[model samples]
Target: MIKQTQKINFGKRSGLEVYPVSMGAMRFPEMDKAIPLIRQAIDAGMVYIDTSRGYGDSEIKLGKALKDGYREKVILSTKCSPWVFKAEDTDDSSADCTYKRILESMRRLDVEYLDFYQVWNINSPENYEKATCKGGMVDGIRRAVDEGLVGHIGFTTHDEPENISRYIDEADWCEVILLTYNIFNQKYKDVVAKAHEKGIGTIIMNPACGGMLAENSPVIADAVKSAVGISDAVEAGHRYLKSDPNVDTIICGITKPEDIESTIANFKKPAFDAAQISAIEKAMNKLSPDNAKVCTSCKYCMPCPAGIDIPAMMDVVFHDKVLKVPGIAKEKYDWLTGENNKNASKKPSECTACKECEAKCTQNIPIAAEMAYLARREEQSWK
Candidate 1:
């Protein structure tokens, strides 16, 4: 049994006590199998359940899981797009769009009301302005609140660091803010602290950067093992995120029962001290220089024209080069090339050197070159 590691009073006026770790239902394999894992997390004291319209059948799975009194035990958070752009605009159209989306989410989740409904992907000030305009999405949210369909208003974003500050500053009625934050990019730290100061609860997404920190990360593993005497790298990665007081909760996309068990085991450890944090940081800074060029698996550079799973390929490269695990890398590369892969058999060998993916990269990585290099390396290794 996992003791409640930490619970925060969410939203200065909401009077809701929330666990500092949220169960993210974004990466489940099958609903029937996923339900037990969800229940296991709840049993482990992680009761804040986060899902979204975009997370492929995740809401339906959650709806099924929450049956027989589980719904009432957790704080449910879901998101939907707020914009309804039509060639011809009507006065009440935007509100109607937002309301319809909320209703759709509720129906999908088989719930009467949402504890928290977020305006998804608030990426810029312009997006914010459009969402809060007169007769816009905020009006729709207000209507839902009055009708008891949604209890509170919140938003999720992937905007630049400066824009995150802008969102927090302008978030007058927001009860919560979900944003990308992890040990890799601590730029959001100050903005998150500012949000906490304003009584807006903060939930961090991508704490492991879509499993990057948790997978074959030797630098982080060594650092964590040295600093805290914890041999599990994933546990140390999570502990680093939980150490921040400004972080009210962190949403980890757990797929298996073992994932929850690991999380519970790590949360049992107290937050890292100043010296420990410093030591870990020092250890991490000593990683191979090329390791920084490796894909963070954020998928910010996505929707490739050639349909290549760029981040996945880059993960293979990192594993082969830095992690010294060529067999695992080759196996993962094979998985990416297999028929069952959702993105199709999009091997790096298929890259056309078009440089389109590079343009969208936040890290400005030479994606085409890397793709070519991976292809050559894999071909030679196979032969």
Candidate 2:
């Protein structure tokens, strides 16, 4: 229960009183199992919900949970997939698909109107062009707004900092932007500030940096616990995000009823003082290897042809080389490569030096080379 009364006047350009901690309805279970978690979030004062059409059953599950009067309690935000527009043969076709998707989302959510509708995954310059082109999704969104189906138009992106800043600068019609922001990658801080300067509300996604901050990295966990005087690493991560004055709200995917409770409790915890934050940052930089490229573990470089767990393997480098915790690194590396972890069928050693993963990396990391490094280290280390 966040007691500090931290709320955001989201969409100052467009009008919703949103909470500082929004619920991301991405990882919920089936309807019967998900309702309690949704109810718990509502009870905890999280008044905003963010979902996506691409997130499998997220919208439908949210629709089911928001039934029985829960609908009136929260503002809804969902995305229209870019693929919907890309598949269109003509701009008018794209517009039609956009309108249809909005209606479909409304039908699935069982909602009369949505508070926010986002253009999902605008990562490239071409995406921005398609979004803003005449008779395209943007036009459709405007029409949806005119007809009272959507209250505001927004977007979510995984683009680099410069492009993101450019998008914010150019998108005056967009009232809100959802983006990746966390401890490891604060390069977008200036852009987030710029959005605030332009009166556009910002929502932080991946505040845990794809669960890197949530992992049981001994040095990180200890430093965070000491910084906040708390034992929970997840709570510490949430608190770190909440500490940023520029961040209006943090959207986190809650998988359980207890997750909602923990999220709320964590948000209520006081932000770290300046000195504490400095100390924590210092510890992170000191422990992290200067030689290794920072991998935020966005998992964009996935579905490795050789079936390597590229993201998890990258974390192994951070733990073993940077953090200098070979024991923890070895444990995770072994688990991910072994049959114990159901999803990880292939080891880092199986990397075929295929440059496919590198091509998709947003950070332009030499992912194949990093995989090779991990393989070499694994061979040498028996301790």
Candidate 3:
């Protein structure tokens, strides 16, 4: 059992306190499995629970899990997706549409009120405009708060750091901010600090870089071990994020009981002092020239119109070049292209330079060019 620890103030503006580590319900298993996992997390002191309407059936399952008095122990949050409105009709961006979405989310989650409600997926300038435009999603959430349906309103983003800074500057209604930050990507580090200075609660998503940092990388593990005596890459990555005082909390996607156990155990470890944290950061800096080339495998550039597994292809390249393990890279490439893997729908050779994947990439990688290079390398028998 995890012991209760002193809670930290989420932010001066947000007016909430919570554990330093929280759980994101994006990867929860089926209903039966999810219920116990949710209960276990809350009992173990991870009391901030975040979910989204965009996550398929997640709200429904969470509603079931939070029953039997489990709801009272945690901070509950959910996001409203404006793109869902646009898909139905452009007129649906109105406040009425957002209010209705909030109601639906409440009904699904079986919750009377939410601690935090966000305008979800503000990924581009256009999306930011749509969400904040006259009588838009933000207005709708404000309406809910007015009527006691929400505690605080905020936004989640995948936009570039400059755009995110702009959003924070303009969003007077925002009381909290959720965005991606991890060991492999620190581009948002400045943005997070900026939000902290403004007294907005900062919750970091993708602290593990969507499982990329969790994979066995002796190079990364050794560097972290040398600096802090922590060899597990996943734990090291979590510790790195926790070392940032500007960050209020980090939301990790937990799928199983063991995941929760490991997460809690990792958080329970003593935090790195300033010098140790700096040493680890310097070591990682020496490993990669720029974060843009490092893929977090967030899969934002996914569902390729041409059916390419772009993350898998990028992972192969990452292992080859960054991790300096050609053998592991070749094995991954084989598995990605192997016929036995039912999900291997398309290989890098099938890439047509559509550029759609490039547009949605959070890292701004030249994905088309990388695809072409991978295809050529395959032709040369991976020489």
TM-score of 2: 0.78
Each prediction's Cα lDDT score?
Answer: 0.78, 0.77, 0.83
Per-candidate TM equals 0.78, 0.78, 0.80
Kindly report which residue pairs in candidate 1 clash with one another. none
Per-residue lDDT tens digits for candidate 3, residues 1-383, read 76448799888888889888898988899888889988988887789888888788888988999999999998999986756433245436678988888888899999999988888878999988878998888888889999999999888888899999999899989888999988767889999999999989999998876675666777777877887787887888888887889999889788987877887678777777889878877777766634535777889998998888888888888776677556667778898888967788587878889899889988888998888887887788777
How much does each candidate deviate from the true structure in C-alpha RMSD? 5.9, 6.5, 6.6
Which one is best on lDDT? 3
Model 1 lDDT tens row, 172-243: 878998988766566687888998889898899987655666566565566668777887766766788778
Q: Of the candidates numbered 2 and 3, which has the greater TM-score value?
A: 3
lDDT of 2 by residue, 19-93 (tens): 778798888887788887787788677778898876778888888888899998888888876553332344232
Question: Which residue segments of model 3 deviate by more than 4 Å?
Answer: 84-91, 289-316, 319-321, 324-347, 351-383
Model 3 scores a TM of: 0.80
Native-referenced Cα lDDT, model 3: 0.83
lDDT of 3 at 83: 66
Q: Which ten residues in a row have the lowest lDDT in candidate 3?
A: 82-91
In terms of lDDT, model 2 sits at: 0.77
